[model samples]
Target: MIACPRTLFWIVLLVAACFLAGTTSGAASVPAPADGPGLTVVMDNNYPPFSFRDANGELVGISVDLWRLWEQQTGENVQITGLEWDDAIRRMEAGEFDVIDTVFYSEERGEIYDFTAPYTDVDAVIFFDADLPGISGLDSLDGFVVGANRGDSTVKELQEKGITVRKYPSYEAVVSAAKAGEIVVFILDKPGGVYYLHREGIQDRFHYSAPVIRGQLHRAVKKGDAALVTKIDEGFASIPKAAYDDLDRKWYGTPVAEPADLRLITFFAIVAVLIILLLVVLNHTLKQSVAMKTEELKQELDHRRRADEALNRATQKLGFLNAITFNDLQNAVFSLSGFLELEKSLPADEKTLAYRQKQAEILHQITAMLRFAKNYEDLGMKPPVWQNVSQTFLIAISHLDMAGLRRTITLDNLEIYADPLLERVFLTLAKNVLLHGKTATEISLSCKRTQEGLVLVFEDNGAGIPLAMKEKIFERRFEGKKGLGLFLAREILSITGITLTESGTEGQGARFVMLVPEGAYRFTDNS
Candidate 1:
């Protein structure tokens, strides 16, 4: 049978009220127990779906609902205390709370608290600014600045795996920072990300990458609270599957994952034992068979060794090819820039200058394509080298046919650490506008430093993308036949820890905003 936690809380409150009323009548002048042993649950009030503040600023959510059920079924008072996420975690670790709600279990965390059977499945997702390209998976996030909620297991897991994690105080802060372009990627639980996107009204702008980090969400209690853990597990088991499903639907708009059945484990164990017995019986009759199997294993090991060698060689070759391609593109852009400069000096003839300008633009396109390809490949394998932001901008502009297009580029020239390869990111975007921005006669580029990091703007006077296409454009190969110019641009920018997103869809033309994190420009000693 399922016990509704919310209903139980109300029932308890009602009973307490009646008890106080009857006691006031001087029936028995006795005091209630002060501090008897009971369950203490710590929960964060700001986490929606899991837990959050209601209109009255009271803590409420699925966890709150479940705890009420525990109280009602056991007829015991489980004191629920609200605290901030960080404070709650610390208190739980210190054994101040007998139970902590909505914890994701990990091997490291298991050392601190005993975990209940998993009740939910969570997958980690990457959140970026609306204009940024969608990340395909963890590989796409290599070398990108990713934000995570501080004290979260997600942060711990990422850091432990050698992925850089920027810690924020709250999920709201993480989203705000990501939207403001302080971080290129924000890693979060899928459900949490969805809830946050809807709450922040940015659902149309941001998306989750297809690949996810899968994990189990389980309840946790103090390490020594074996009895409480067992009781909670029992409570969970007693709940009807339908009731659990309904609660999941209410919170996440999806059915909850069914608990894993132990039948498969039992079956596998039985199969393994039979196989072992068969092997033992055969061993006595076939001594020669063991030698033949050993030879086969040796051959298999040799083949694997060769495959590993081949893979290493392939990786090295790819890296070399990328480096060579980048250098070639750089030289080609320099040559084009020089030619354009010479065209301006020679003649004022309109037709001749126009031809030269067109040639320069074409060259610029080729240069951008090569650079974009190189950067895209590099992001998956190497960390970007930190360089001056101004330098990156200049490299990007070098690929622009500025003399022919007659566009002005302005900047505050603020110095910050940035990836040199990010030059391709801007070049590709500028080229995209020149090629497709039909209504645009002018393009403007500029940058500004904010309290957190930097914001780069690329605006064009061309007719903006249709309202419907604005969000879809960042999708990988979204236009089907269209090449991956914009997608590649987004990928490269992400590598340098910048998120590219579209802004002001209702305005005259398209405006792309790139939020660059401070980490993107940090200078290392070698640099």
Candidate 2:
């Protein structure tokens, strides 16, 4: 009976050894499976190429492949589960899973999980509107709201760096928000972001920075799980180099190596030869078509250039003629004003005096109109430029007689993209305060950063504009009542998507706020 029991034990051991050898012939370093329950491996369900559902809804990716290889090598039964990244982490921390992959190593994470050697590196990046200039890295995100995926390691990383990030549910959601114009700046993993950007076909609308943070992805267990850690490490270490490389090639787009077949090579060579022969036959036709298209395009461009030149010449001639006419009109108005003044000195009846006063008022109106025309003629003649706010304000004040009034500017080292007439905007504003701001003692200019963009505030402590005239003050028809400078200022700002609005208490002051849209203003180092 004793011999029989011993023989049965030997038979059982032989069968188990045979099974292990068959499963992992070259992987001797892999430890034998523990006798208890199998491991539960969990990973992100939507992270493509690293573990995501295929079109058929089957879970797949490099992480999935590596785990399966580990299972085979170690002779362990691993039940793999796919969940959203946050849920996966939450469940694993809840003790629902024994292992998790596709996780980045951070100090906070290291405190909760025991990480294995890194399997891959993922770069985190910042993507902003292509038109938003001067944003080179994280330091450039000051005063701007940034968006990111909820529960991502990147969010924590950014928070640690003191960057304020708006969280979305996923990278796809971030891209959708950007497309909807809800967000201008966002963060995401480079590969995933590129995938969604290309899929949405809005890749050209955004610019991304170089890797802001490179997270080494690893498979980890709850902290203090040394047994499981050892198994995972050894299991992966035992995988053949070629097998590991194959996984990378299959999922990460590295080209696969294959044995060359002479038959296949010969067949491709013949096809290439046939293609070349056909190309040679069609080369003359293609060259003729291309040459004709090129010549046609060249002729069209030449015609467009000549037409542009002709239009410019016509514009110049009209301006010259208008200038001459304006000069003649000014001289005539000047002579009329002199005659009216001379008439004023001569004694006249009441009715004649009223007629002479009316004539003088009409002449003054004509002179104001002529001055407006001269200033308005140059509007939009030159392209918009970036002007320093403080410097431009000084220039505008230089052109005005700002005596008896204290001028205050708190604009910092800010700059704006506006038409060259930007100077006219400040000049016109200052002139309005001097002319209309009765009881006004001080004029102040400042800026406030907001979600929509920058608000340039121009305020004055004066009798303030009557509530009724706020909107009408910018109307073209109001030009005769309140001069045309305000109307002209509105037009100049609108050319660059900036808006002007009056928002102040009637008794407090006249507050004109110019809304400078994002991408139209930036702060310098002095700010």
Candidate 3:
């Protein structure tokens, strides 16, 4: 509740001198029974709805009406005086009034006044211009200039949070500054602020957050005035609950419905019906569109299925023909070998013998080329798979003579996405090491991770490749070699975007690095 006593005080003087009129002539005036004890009440006159001067130049509000009823219940002469909040507090402490209504209790005030039980709760909130972003409470007012009444408790609250605030004399002045575009952020009691905003037709220009501080409104008497406290509480308690509800309704409830309200209600009902109808039509149209699209997709899937079956049939036929051709060619080469062997036994001149030897060498190269082609025929025939690197390397070395060779594999349980012929790649590298790695004793396979990818390495303690031939070695034309092993290894790896490169010291060893791009490799275990 925004009703902090000392901090909320604000001066709004009435020039008409109508301050004492309510005590003598308004509904608050009560005939004094002879010798009856009396109580004088004071509160902020400028606080709207709770206490304020009406346009008729007379002080009237919930507080005023409440005290009038209190007089009837207690049979005591009650004097209700309205002044600026600060002035009311000053005069009450000066002993000019017996009670001050609409006050918030605080520790400092506890030493000066004895407060009655709280009668109502009010909320204090942060009100900001609608255009101001992120202004929810005191904490959010850091960069913006905030406005508050000169003595408002909210001002101190803002200041404590390290926010700067511009002080005004009263809430009225604060609202005026907002309307003038002088201040875009301010704090005020919600009810009074809302009432003023509506009256001025500026409610749309500002937005308010939920209560930043909730305070209970109470009436207070001089310290040590226990008798007066009891009288005030008892008088209020004696009033019927319905009476309090009526006052709340009069001040805060929905306005009384008029004849024009029925027409407004009718217009809103028609708009709501139209909106519902529009939604129903839109829903029906969307369902029809979805159904049409679903049918089109089903037809597309069926067409692809038929095309895939045809492709598979053609591939199987081609594979069978290729197998037959390869078997016939191998048989022809074997027969030629027998003929050459017989010819060797028949002595010939040196020149003729040299030509025969040359022919045999060409036959051997041709055989090696045919074997390579057979092996590569299935490359990329199937989708790439996640092969366990360590296991695959072991399988590759199994086909080689390893009587004296030692192998070290630190690839862990790493898996890489590559052509099924991935194992063939490792086999080719191992074979190269055995054939070309002069003086090599050990071969090792390992992997290291880099930003671009995982580098799968194969190295052997051998006469390593020369710097000039590192890349050229992967080319099929290298050394005019008939075996396409290295060249095909690169093709197999490239199927899944992996690259093979050699990066070994010339005299130290041979190192083959296969870079498995990111997303193509991962470890299966904690190695």
Give the TM-scores of the predictions, in the order they appear.
0.45, 0.48, 0.45
- How do the residues 1-527 of candidate 1 rate in per-residue lDDT, one tens digit apiece? 22222322322332232233333323321122245577788877556556665555556566766766566566566677877678889888887778887777778888888988876555677776443553676666555567888878777667756776778877777877655535656887765566666656666656667536777667888777789789988876776576566554444332122224345666799999999999987876576777889999996775455445434544665676567667766776777777777676777788667758777775766656565464456543543444445445544554344322435455543444333446676677777777777667777777777876778788887777778777667764412335466666665565445687888454477888888776444333422
Give the Cα error of residue 190 in candidate 1, in Å.
1.3
Candidate 1 residue spans exceeding 4 A from truth: 1-37, 239-527
- Residue 126 miss distance in model 3 (angstroms): 0.8
lDDT of 2 by residue, 4-96 (tens): 112223223322322332333335222334455798889887665466655456676567767767877777777889987778888998999
Sort the predicted structures by TM-score, highest score first: 2, 1, 3
Q: Residue 257 error for model 3, in Å?
A: 9.4
Q: For model 3, what is the error of residue 393's alpha carbon versus the real structure, in angstroms, after optimal superposition? A: 68
Question: In model 2, what is the error at residue 222, expressed in angstroms?
Answer: 1.0
Q: Report the C-alpha displacement of residue 236, candidate 3, in angstroms.
A: 1.1
Native-referenced Cα lDDT, model 1: 0.63
Clashing pairs in 1: 5-69, 47-51, 131-500, 131-501, 131-502, 132-500, 417-521, 418-521, 440-462
Clashes of 1: 9
Residue pairs whose backbone atoms clash in candidate 3: 1-122, 1-123, 1-214, 1-215, 7-151, 7-152
